[model samples]
Target chain A: MSVLLSPERVEIQLGERSYPILIGNGLLGEPRHFDAAPAAASALIVSNTTVAPLYARALRDTLAGRFQAVHMLELPDGEAHKDWQTLNLIFDALLRHGCDRKTVLFALGGGVVGDMVGFAAASYMRGVPFVQVPTTLLAQVDSSVGGKTAINHPLGKNMIGAFYQPRLVMCDLATLSTLPARELSAGLAEIIKYGPIYDMAFFDWIEANIDALMARDPAALAHAVRRSCEIKAAVVGQDERETGLRAILNFGHTFGHAIESGLGYGEWLHGEAVGCGMVLAARLSQRLGGVDEAFVQRLSALVERAGLPVVAPALGLERYLELMRIDKKSEAGEIRFVVIDQPGSAAMRSAPDTMVREVLAQGCAS
Target chain B: MSVLLSPERVEIQLGERSYPILIGNGLLGEPRHFDAAPAAASALIVSNTTVAPLYARALRDTLAGRFQAVHMLELPDGEAHKDWQTLNLIFDALLRHGCDRKTVLFALGGGVVGDMVGFAAASYMRGVPFVQVPTTLLAQVDSSVGGKTAINHPLGKNMIGAFYQPRLVMCDLATLSTLPARELSAGLAEIIKYGPIYDMAFFDWIEANIDALMARDPAALAHAVRRSCEIKAAVVGQDERETGLRAILNFGHTFGHAIESGLGYGEWLHGEAVGCGMVLAARLSQRLGGVDEAFVQRLSALVERAGLPVVAPALGLERYLELMRIDKKSEAGEIRFVVIDQPGSAAMRSAPDTMVREVLAQGCAS
Candidate 1:
């Protein structure tokens, strides 16, 4: 059966300027996928040491046929290396291989690779064209869709970056077959985010089919990836730079980033951090009169079902408080959280330390 | 005579997405001036050790009254120091002072400080609201307005950064009063860039008043800053990410960056390197049929008039070609130059090394 997907392309209308994010299957090998990118120049593929082994050859094999040349720059995997020292690999490869402003950089890995490649494209001789070909479910569903490109610093995660949207985001569901089960679970936390922040019904659907998703069912995964991209594209299209509506998309990120920063990088996957963070935010929401006990329980059950860490790791209350205050969402050192009154509805709000501490203590109870 | 000569504020209209460029006198002390920046929950001011002592106090004193509270982070001075290690200083300062996403950052210094501070602000917790309080001429007129914030790398210049915009760009012409004459001349290189790429009228104005500008005449300086900012704002507003029209803004940058990269940072001022680069670009432009001997003579005359180097530094022609190819702008190691077809019109083009060598050789003749 030769099925046709609408490509469900969303244009991030920046007026006389805009870009598309394409979501579907078997996209990597398709020539039509990159027609929007600059055709007169070379294309650079920046993938991780891991992802390159699986998909780089096919991507290069595809682009090399049409473009003047195709080259690959393999970066070491993990969040620890997503800093200046490691990002230079792309530059070193670009220089060694000879890529220019017209050179289109394809980020063919997960969040680490996509963010690094995106930022590299953003600052490479001021900026260059980049396309997102996210392999991991987490990146396909979130990081690759938005224009937010950045690198992690020692003091914080994603501490250096820019709001540079890709020329196109090609999300091929077929790639997820190779993702680790733990990573697949981690990606769900963000997918679950869309349903709660904007579509309560979508959350309920995931609630019912959590088992099928855990098995990496293609139909289920495609639906989740396509819908998540739809929601993200819609939010980002309207508020591309998170000045307003897009902030809601960070439903659990304010809390999630705190946990990630508090524990240090690599100890927990980004999704794992958000999974635990959502629990605390749910509790805080209940106290603030934004969300009730039933809502908290509903979300927690989903977190647990997704095979994510539902309970916060035991870092002392002071450290938790200190870390949360250092969050990008904090103002004047005041801790902020993107809280939900109910599924599909969210708000960015500030909370006092006393309430946050109580939620932290409750989060550790499990 | 209480003559209030506003530095002709230019409105860079991107609709509801538009921002103002404040080009005038003693704006730091004016209470309303700080209001140009939206009231954020928190704010951080990123300045250099040198600029901080001179102006950070006034900035903090002003922003403290507006933002939730002001946090100050001081970094070292000079291009050599504007790297990840220096950027870590801002991140460390933010974490130590407990800044969050709601915090707005104010970049209070020249290009080195502005680029690093803007980069720190962009990467701090993914992204944050930043204001550009540019002190030097190069920054006040060019880097400060374009949202092209970055730092030089061990391998290349601006290899790490983002196309992150500032909420407001406050160019206090008074700050230039303290800029050393050599530094002032360095900035004039960028001032000369506008005349050739997009504004011949401004170029002629610079040619006419070279002496007053060299003397750091406030009126002449303010005029240059305002006109340059307007040209930059128009270009950036049309092409915020250097996709097309914005590339023209890099007229002298390709050659300038190679010199900076070859000699290593801080050996010569960025404007000085650019001053030299513009001369080489002019010669290259003449070779490629984009410019005439008359245009080259005008550029050389201006560089000489500004008391800046009008020839490529003796870093070896082979080294120059190799370094230029590794720049963020180079693709597949093929160097691209933003050459003028005529004064006020520029384009990114490729040329032969044989021709470039002739230009390199011309530098030796001098």
Candidate 2:
């Protein structure tokens, strides 16, 4: 039987714009994989320098039959390059090649490429259709599923962006095989988050399969990605703009963003910052009596075991506070963090500055 | 009687995000006029240097009752300043002030200020509430009513933007009294467009009262703005993202955008370029047998009477063709023009290259 016959599909129902997330081994070679996207006269595949050599040619070849012309743009790699200057490169390519509003953009790399391409599609001629073919584990389980597209600002992370959905999100399990060990651990940080914040049972599953995930087991990775997507889809569907419950999905993002912005973008892998941030947020939860101290300890151990940072960098407590104050969740300069109420529940609330400072002072390197 | 008590209100319905446009002689000074905006602790008034000195103080004082703090960001004036670098200035003020997601942005200038501020609000912290306090006739009638917000790219006009709606649109007619003669005439160009594309009766009304509008008669300006808004509201309500009916709204914009892009943005006031483009389009419409040549001459005469351009710029035909091809309406390298079917209806179509060249050669002033 052909690999196309039975690939697992995850449906993200967003009214008329609903699309599917196709997951399976060797799915990139299957033409049927792009079924959700409408056929356009031209297709532009945006990838990074690192990932282009690995997968862009095969993806382009697969798209050749459907599109009259296929174009490829290889941007410099890393989160540091995710800004307006780099975003302009995609627009320059699209316009130079005479691509029109109906053109479809295929993002063929990690979160940075997916995000910038999605934003380019969203703003190009007001809006256009784009497909997310995320290759990183963090993206497959997290960023690629939701319609949140953005680029970082000098002062903040994902500061400039739009809530633009993708035509489809294609996650090929085979691509993760080529990911670096450090990058793989970063993806695990996000995978580990869904359990404590949305589903405790999934959290337990992650704890049990952490070894297999690290070892790159196909079955284990598939289960983690699908479960994470389901939780994200349900959250995003209810609150597409993060006006309410959707903010819960940024479980460790408040602290993680501070670390990322403080250290400068790309210094710590996004997942690494988030991993350490989750620990800080859990401690804040314990301090607020929302979760037990033991809950914080258990979560930190998992992050460490996954080879991610359990402790944040030694940015002073005042620096951390300054960075966190400007977060989107902050209201009138008051920071609101997503804290765990229990093993599987999360909500946003402001903590005392003293308590937060204590968490920062004591939360490092543990 | 207070001007706010008898202000004409037009509701732009877009489901839950609908907002009202208030048109009156001096609505800015009335505290009760901003009742529609959600109460926020902080408000930022984004105005240009030209407009800020004139009205920022009054708007700030009006907002002071509802908001705890009101800040002003005075951007440099002109379409030349509408780029990413200038847009960054708004971001700098927002971040420096530690403004939160709930902080409202009040766009208090013409099309340039309003468009940039709306986009800044849309992208800042994913999205934020904004109010369009358009002070120019051009912005009051066209740019502010619809949720189309963007900044120009070196390669195109309004290329980078989003369809983000505002909380309220306040068009204080008294402010237009300060507009330059050339600027007032530019505004008339857009006001003239509403008639040919959507309402022939309004077209006749404009023809009859062209002198009254030019004289800045409050009654005449009020009727023209109100009717133009009603038609724009209807079009935008039916199609917010320009997927279909909304393209009709860009009646002369395809060619107008070409001139704006080809001349380098800000060289011609947007409405000036559009006035000339309307004549070219009307001529093209007659050439294609969509309308009669007499209709073209009559429209051209009215444009001239409004102190606007009737003949196209002497940009080479090839240059015009090259510029028009990248417009938002173009598809698969085909340039789509919004041609008149009669005096009051418009649709998009591509004309033969030779006929377009002929129109250009005979249509330009030189």
Candidate 3:
């Protein structure tokens, strides 16, 4: 199944900060995949307890030929550990090892690992080169491609971070073979996200290949990852800083963030909350007359089919509003949401409380 | 003294990230000084316990006319407090007050406050617009002008940070009147730094007016800050990230950082350490034949007259080497020093341990 698809590359054109996203099977073990990494005396692979045991060794071995020394540091798994303490662990390891400005960092695993490592690289000695070796479908499709790196603060998600770009992003599809079933579905949430916000053709393809993707068919997953990266690369290339068009990428993130913060980080996988949040955002789009009932229902059905929750937790309307107000996107206490102006189109807008309440009342469980 | 000098502006050109350094007497109370700050609903003035009582209110009052709401958060004073624990306070205040990405931050103190606030603004929601309101002489001439912002780690000084720029830098000369005599001397260390590294004319000016600068003469202080900023701005504009040419600005910082880290931070103010470090670097420069012994002695005498210690701390040879290997300027365990090529020029070079040892032996108190 792996031999059925060839490797693909997506370029994120950020001028001097530009790099490529390499996607294929078994790319993690191929030293040639990392040929573009900056020449340095040392390389450090930063992963988590779970993924390190699975893929860190392969990455270190591949990098050994290029660097004089290759080291590995595993952080505790999950979003709960994505704080200053865990981030400092990476710094401590680098300083302890006497890593210098030229040292390259490789982020292995899911979104949590990618974000933290990208941030650690961004911050360690001001800035250092880093490569992303994303193992999960969610990261391979979304987080790994973009250079947005951050750690979660107790008050808000990704409250502290930098717009630091990575030297390379390696999405080895083979690693997805070890991903948990629940996690695969969470990744699908982000893949499904691209369809509603930008491309209906991609959405149609996902709806048709949902079963093949669920079964972990290599060709179907390859196309999914490739298309997702292409779309993301295009959006990010245009609005790398999220000053305007980039906010559309957060289509479901306002509601998604509230749920994650309300339930506490790590309670629900980020993709899972985003999946449900997309449904709520689609519903709000209908209330704003940007989309029809059919489109909202269609997105909800797809979200549910992806094995994500369509119904949000009953955190109460006031609590939800409070959480969203503090989201990084909000300004002057107004919660800015990414609403679908139409299928395959999105815009950042603020909905009135009465209308938002109606969407919440209908989306949340009683 | 206050009316002797008119407001002056030095432009730091870095393309879109370029901003001005405003220098004058009583600039903090003038609302017109901050006209260039981004329009936002709210602003946060991050200061220290010592500086807040003195000028936070005046700055806040000036900002009130622009921003709908203005708030203040004061952290403990000194270099000892420049850590993650202190950095998080700014984040906590921003999130707790529901400050968004558009919210402006004004750093209202010396190097410690400016570095922390700039870092908080850089990391808060990826990045935010911030203004530097440097109060101390050192900050006004150095830290505030450059976009280098970070907190000290247990392992190293500024080992974690970002090259995030500010929208404006305000240097109110009036604030220096209240500065302690020792701190004022520390600021002179940085003002003196510009002479050997970039401009010998500036160095000559400092040598001649050292007494007037100590007396808090507004005209003398204003000229010192304006020239120092102009030199820094020109250097920073050419190499904002310290990739090559920018590193020359750390003419004495390599030795200064080791001294600070060896004795523990806050034991010696950054400028004071640099004052002494410059003497040691000058001696090393003489050994390397970059400068002559007569030049080194002349610089050392000026440092002493400015009330800064010309002799280095007795941290021993090995301790200094170990501390210096971890300095940010060092690459791959090899210590890089910014040696004076001549009286008016500097270069980043690596000297032998034997040479460094001899210089340390002569410079440090036995």
Candidate 4:
């Protein structure tokens, strides 16, 4: 069965590893999501408890029609469960079920589920084919699109991971209907990010259409996802390994990740942390003369209006610094921040401890 | 200081991931071995307890001259310890040392150390540069050059892994002098493999120089390693991902992995298992009419002469079948064996269960 909405497709070109991102409503029912996926003898659907009951059966049925055997592995939901122990569950299930390298894995959940499954597939049999059926807004626009598969370490976010590309990314917007309002707001943080980092026009659109998106208007959600993925696809196509250009896509992530790790992962939703992170990043950018105070305020106002935190969490200046220094972007002991040069532009740069502290103090309630 | 024999370099070209394999004695002390390595702030020499006391100090001294921080993570030696827990030690040390992505890891042991360190580099910060200073004949000739890094699972050997290539592979013949005779014999199992699978001439050379290799002649070891790496480099360059041509390189691995898993990892050194596995594969080839029994007997004689197990352990047919089916090469429960079409040639094809059973019955002592 095909979805009603004409699926907007964005191709992430990395030569032989290039894959298509299919964004559409009611895509769970669409058989075409499995079209580009390699015809495997068996398919394993990896979803969390929160997502399995809603979409696992339909996904299994769709996959079953194509594969000889379809197995569903339900993981405990939440970012805290995204570790090696939980990843082992997928490996255990795959091995028990006699799944081979040809066995395809379908990641059918939010960012946490997608990231864990992608990593599981990446390591299983030294790498296997996986299809990302992203159910949450955070996954569709960011994590699932970029091929950055990882499991978080206690010391850092996405510490143990791989640059494994997926065979196909199916973003079924219909699944977002079951999403909590908090999660929807969290996803908007990433959505709001593309505007300041790559395209100011898209930022303008997100500002104008925030309400419509919060309302879960299918058209608005589809357009936002499509545009965000397009920008991500373009950036990822240029730098799949995050050597240079890809760091810009992490516009607010350096600070965002610090906030996430400092407060403990899943304490704040990844997007929520990133949303707050964008505010701090904007302030830091302004302090560095990349942008003005007015621009920072404008972005902060939008983040707040999106129902995300405009103010940073009091993770403490030193603790945040400690966490940020360990971030993948940090070279030597110097912490690199992906600061916005201006609207529609961002680059990774290091700032002095005093200036970073000044922004943290100004942005946090403490 | 440079050694007596000039080091020969073999380049395994995989476009951007292409790296050098330096084969010579006393090369580890020479700084030229690391000339191509990315100049990093720190270097973590990931060796083991056995290798550490013997060579870590010298390697550390050599690396310390170049890198500001030269840290060593000494793990428990042996294949039994090559699991996620031991790998975590490397991760923990890197994090504790404030090692960043620029931190180059040196796998300074045999196959186990090289595989673990390479996998660590592959996962750490998504990807980092690693140098393989393989100290065993098996590793120097095969595992070190190909970039097939992995840790074993309870169900299979090398089950959990990644195809992460190293920046450089340094084979110091001096280290092999300390290798136990049994360990040396195990390495010869892999060295003898090159002839039957890829080069008949190399096979003839191995038959001719078996005594020279076993006697620990430096020139003999260097020549064997250089030729083995050349065959491996040619194979790996043609098929980096092991989709087609690379599978042939695992001429005996399908059966060999089963033997290792059945006997339990470390019970039989990897090369010993492969030596017996090559005999089984040869017998299977004869059964499939791919080769004559003479080829099987000839290979088995050489394996026995080299002090490797020519007869397989009685793992029982059912258990062997169970283990072999889960191998990465097996497709859809059809156990694909890399059979010798003739000496110096191999092809992956599935044999019938009955034929496989017969081969097992003939090969196993039971």
Tens digit per residue, CA lDDT, model 1, A1-366: 123365556565665447777766677888878788767468789898899999999999888866788888889899888887888788778766656667789899999999999988877766778899999889988999778888876766776677787887888777887899889988999998887789988888898888989988777887788788888878877887777788888887876887787778878999999888888888888998877788888899999899998888888888888766656556566666888876578888888888888988888733
Per-residue CA lDDT of model 2 for A1-366, tens digit only, reads 123346788888788777888887888988888888878999999999999999999999999999999999999999999999999999889888888878999999999999899889988877889999999999998889888899988888888888889989999989998999999999999999998898988888888989998998888888888888888888888888889999998989999999999988989999999999999999999998888978988999999999998878988889899999988889988899999988899999999999999999898653
Ranking by DockQ: 3, 4, 2, 1
Interface C-alpha RMSD per candidate, 1 decimal: 2.9, 1.0, 0.7, 0.7
On residues A1-366, what C-alpha lDDT tens digit does candidate 3 reach at each position? 555345698899989999998888888888888887899999999999999999888888888899998988999999999999999999999999999999999999999999999999999999999998899999999888879999999899999999999898988888999999999999999999999999999999999999999999998999999999999989999999999998898989999999999999999999999999999999999999899998988889988888999999999999999899999888899889999887899999998988999999999999
Model 3, span B1-366: residue lDDT tens: 556345899999999998988899888888888898999999999999999999998888889999999999999999999999999999999999999999999999999999999999999999999999999999999999889999989999999999999999989999998899999999999889889998998888888999999999888998999999999998998899999888988978889999999999989989889999999999999998988988998999999999999888999999999999988888878999999998888999999998999999999998
Cα displacement (Å) at residue B62, model 1 = 4.6
B1-366 per-residue lDDT for model 1 (tens digits):
122455457777665557889878888777687677877767878888788888989888877778767888788888989887888788878777666676788889998888887877777766777898998888888888877778766677787677677888888877777888888998899999999999899898999999999977778887888888888888888887666788888888888888887778888899998898899898899999988998899889999899898867788888888888776666566688899987789999988888888888887323
Residue B182's lDDT within candidate 1 is: 84
**Per-candidate total of colliding backbone pairs:** 21, 0, 0, 0
Off by over 4 Å in 2: A1-5, B1-5
lDDT of 3 at A324: 90
lDDT of 2 by residue, B1-366 (tens): 124347898999899889999999899999999999888889999999999999999999999999999999999999999999999999889988888888899999999999999899988877889999999999999999889999888788888888999999999999998999999999999999998899999999999999999999998999899998999999999988788888888888878988888888888889999999999999889998888988988899999999998778888999999999888788888889999987799988899889889988988868
Predict model 2's lDDT versus the native: 0.90
**Which tens-of-lDDT digit does each residue in B130-176 have in candidate 4?**
99998888888888988899998777778788999999999999999
**Candidate 1: deviation at residue B337, Å?**
3.9
Q: For every model shown, what is its TM-score relative to the native structure?
A: 0.87, 0.98, 0.99, 0.98
Show model 1 residue runs off by greater than 4 Å.
Answer: A1-40, A287-298, B1-8, B13-17, B24-27, B62-64, B193-208, B230-240, B243-252, B284-302, B327-350
- List pairs with backbone clashes in candidate 3: none
Best by DockQ: 3
